[model samples]
Target chain A: MLTILLQHTVFGIVTGSILLLATIGFSMIYTTKRFLCISHGELLTIGAYTTYIFHVFLGWNLLYSGVIGVVITSLVGLAIARGLYEPMERHGPLVLLFTSVGVTFCLHGILEFIAGPSIRSFRTPILPSIRVGGIPLITMNEIVIISIAMGSIVFLHVVLTRTRIGKAFRAMASNVDLAMARGIDTARISMFVWIYASAMAAVAGILLALVTSVNPDLGWTQILIILAAAILGGLGSIYGVMIGAILLGVVMDVGVIFFPSGYRAAIAFALMIIVLLVKPKGIFGGE
Target chain B: MFRRTRIVRRVLVVGLSLALLAGLSVGVARAEEVRFGVLTSLSGPLGTEGKPCFETIQWTVEEINKFGGPLGMPIKLFVADTATDVERGITGARKLITMDRVINIIGPSSSIVVAIMKFCADNEVPIISHWSGSTRLTTSGGEYQFRTCPDDYFEGEVAARFMWDEGFRKAAVITLDTEDTISISDALKKRFAAMGGEVVVDEMVVGGQTTYRTAARKVLAKRPDVLFPAIDLDTLKIVYRELYEMGITFTVVLASNAVQQATMDIVGADILEGVYGEKPANALGSPGYAIFEQKYREHMEDGMVGWFTPNMYDAVNLMALAVEVAGEATGKGISENIRKVANSPGIKVYSYAEGLAHLLRGHEINYEGASGSCDFDEFGNVLGYARIQQAKGGQWVDIKFYSSEDLAEAIR
Candidate 1:
């Protein structure tokens, strides 16, 4: 009984940590940009596919593949900004959000065109499990995932709390036009945010690939979990998002021990509906 | 002035001749390669199902080419990945029609088949779906759309009858509300109810749910004789954990055939001790089972064995046969010849190599496959048996086989 509990918890944590990183990307994008990027899911998928191409096809090490994945996806984010967000910057959130939708479709089309729309994963074996103190530990990939999630979150916390650029970002998030008038380089900062979000998405995608299979829509599906987390955390509040992500993961996974198995998918949506009904601003929405 | 004028005339004549020759060559090469559009999810969530099908097409083309090509002319496959999105599926169909100008297409896997079927019918391209089992795709009575896999309505009837025969009078259904799953669930529920069996519980899980606790409780409350699930691996893991720990034993637990090896590993085989489901590829079968087991190990790393692989392999061989029977590589000719090659009366052949040998002998051949017999009804649905596989001692062991004919009679 104890062993099963430990196993489920470990699995939940590993899975949750990967989701946390992906939600961070959504948090950063929503906070700074204040636009609904429905296609943010595909960016993570691009990262996963990039990892597959570099690591599996070309025989690059996993670490190097991750680097390639993040770098390439960051550039894709920049391109999305330039092509979709940049042109619509002066427009309202609705217009900008719609443009992101268009960008998502175009990118999805290109990927389908080139990759031939098939699920692909490394032919290399899954990392073998490790046991410690009579509890079977997860794979090395999962260990790396947890570490990366913690490291990225801590790093983001530091960057946000202790840096001048972070202050400028907060200022922009507070009021974009006001920050622009105050002589902050708003465009450059927004570009940096895009890169940062894209990089976070890549990390999430890579970790997810390590944990499970890398389908063409794997990252996109992960985005749904991210949305649930972000919305639970108050949409733009990074701290709230992280807490929400972990909690959401636990509810879906850990909470299942006492609940009916088929109702698990309903829990997340149900929570969303409840949160909206009770606290429309989310747990950490605008002050 | 005379030299310059003569040079200009010479250059103009040479350029015009080169242009004309290039155009003529383009037209001739186009004639040499007959195009067949293949619609499958090369991307998206359901991409795994389409990957092996893609390989089967490749293998078929390669083997066919070794025998001096289909219809003594090279066959070119124009593939567009649908990404498993319905809108993208429609776009893929358009691309195949307008860009490839193909006569027939192979897939888009599931309900996406319905969308592509509409387009293929409109464009007059005969389509033989390799994996999608939605009855609506065939029952719509469309002229151009044909499937190589059994419909869920038929498969569901077989499943319900299996439970009935196994002496389980009370059943519980846990299903996802997706178009495909819902279709199978609804059919199963109606059939089970009509079979004088009590459907003690009916629970619908939202698509893509990873947990199954609340729904599991609902199913447990019914105290069903059997629990039938329409779900995938992720949800199955949660279901197994809750069911076993809660001490819910049953006469049998049954589900749709999508549980991969990974799910078993996650929850242990003890929990799935009596679970049963339907599958197309049973290692117990002949011809390609050995080869499939070997190649599946090599190519599909994901540890999930989908029922679609054998049908995928058979679809390719059928296409190769159509090409031979048509004596031409055009779409119209191939479509006209599909039934001849698939359902013909003769000594049967299995592999592409054997198929080629028979083609050489100018002999009509039936292709018996690893999945089952490759007999197609008028609707192009594969006529075969659904084998019942039970999870015993950590493997999906086959306990019984239900033929379509037998199932049809039982359902009636």
Candidate 2:
């Protein structure tokens, strides 16, 4: 019984790690840019597919291809922010939100057209997994996933709290008009946030593709839980999103022990709803 | 003048109603050229399988046309690309039945076949398929619905019997939560239990998820004697990879759904070795298949046929033979005579020409085509042949072949 519990928790952590990285960007953009970028998930798809193109099609090394994939994905996200969202900034939240939805469809269609509908994976040598005392806890790829998730959380913490740009970003989130009047250059900062967060999500995508299979719907499938994680941790709360992601992951994974696997997604949302009912401002109570 | 106007108005009303009645039902087979609907995917995900299935069926039509095209009228194939999708398939099927006026139609892939079935049933059009393998299509096999391939239900039985024969006493089943997998699992559970094997664990995980580790562990905790995974072909390899990571010791026998090259290639070689499963392949020992192979090679280089191409070839030939047997080019005519021409208790004919000749001479003809004996039971599915394939080295090795009857005998 103890082994089974540990095993499920391990699975949950791995799931939460992926969700953390994917949702971090979503929460960051919401805090600074002040609108839910619905197409944010497609950046994850673009990342994995671009890596696939480099590694599988171009025959580059997986590591180098992953770097290139991340770079390319960040650039695409930057372009989307600058090209689409920035220009429509004055048009109110509703217009920008609908535009993001349109952007989601366009990006999805483009990915479907280019990559086609088949599931693909990188050609990598399979290594034996690390098992302890008859319980299979982790694999090498999963280790990489957990490590990256932790690293990104720490990285985001330092960049937002400790760095000078962090203070400016906080100022913008607190009062955009006052921050701009105080010479913070809010527009460049918003674009910077998109690029950095998109790069982080792309890293998550490559790790995701390595551990699991990569398909056209790779990111779209995870977007719902990502939204739940963001909301559960308090929408637009960076640190809160991290905690929410891991907790939801563990809950869904362990929940399988009690409920059927079909209710995995439902488990995450149920926790979010419960948390919201208890504290309407969410766990961290983001402004 | 008033009397003349009233006469004109009455004539116009009668003429308009007659035209409207004719427009309600689409064109059936016409004089000079007979229209037949080929509803297969020309593009999209299943297009890889769909395109080849369509080509082989198209080639068979061309071959039959050389010999006067089934009842002295040239067969005109009105092709509709389903794009390997259900919505497109439904729309394309509608166009074929209501617009193009085809006598009979070969519908799209498995899921699409289920979707457009009611529409075709309502319109009263006969469907011949090589792609659809879901058992749902055949449960209460109605008129105007028939497939020239084995359905998932029989494949499920084969898995159960195979597991039983392999000395597996305790069976665990993990499958996708789709209707097709349900059909396979339902049959497998019934048959395996009837054979005195205990199903210790049964899990139906949802598709499109990243991992099924929790579900896998839940099934593994039971420590069953064997595992039967009716998972989605894409997810199957991923699950096996996870199980291997977790130190899998039990044996796994897969359903025929996982028997494809694309899957094996992505999953890699040697990973699935000793994993035994059944796949519907050509009847290598049958002369009917041998001759079909020879002709196929003559047309294309390498002459490789995909999974259901032979069954599709048999489907078209059966349609032609049935058309000749019925002596009319209507859906009713073909549906009534389909079983008569394909089933036994008649002289077995291999080629379309041979079947046509036999039918023309007032002789009952049974089609023994590229697929094994093209026999349709009351369920309207052919008793197709399947080869038991075990993954070895980097390729699927054929251990042995089993006919539908052979499988039934073993189950008995």
On DockQ, the leading prediction is: 2
Model 2 achieves a DockQ score of 0.38
lDDT per prediction? 0.71, 0.80
Stretches > 4 Å off in candidate 1: A1-287, B1-24, B42-46, B137-143, B209-214, B233-257, B260-274, B281-306, B344-371, B392-394, B404-408
TM-score for each of the candidates: 0.68, 0.88
Residues B1-412 of candidate 2 have per-residue lDDT tens digits of: 9999999999999999988877554333266677789998665545546666777877888998899887788889999887666788888999999888888888577777788877887777788888577868766564878887777766777777788888999998998876556777787898899899999998888876667887788677889889988776667757778887887778888776666666666676667778887677666667788778887877655477677777888888888888888777777888899988888889988888788888878898877878778788676776667776788887778887667778776433
Error of 1 at B137 (Å): 4.4
Clash pairs for candidate 2: B27-B101
Q: Write the per-residue lDDT of candidate 2 for residues A1-287, one digit (tens) a residue.
A: 78878988997899899889988899889998788888888898999999999999999999999999999999999999889998898997788899998999999888877776466777876555788885678888888889989988888778889988888888888888999999998877887799987997798788777777777777877778888999999887888889989999999988888887779899998999999999887799884
lDDT of 1 by residue, A17-134 (tens): 8778888888888888787777788888889889889897898997899899999999998888787787887787899888877777777767766776333555444423576674
Residue A98 lDDT in model 1?
A: 85
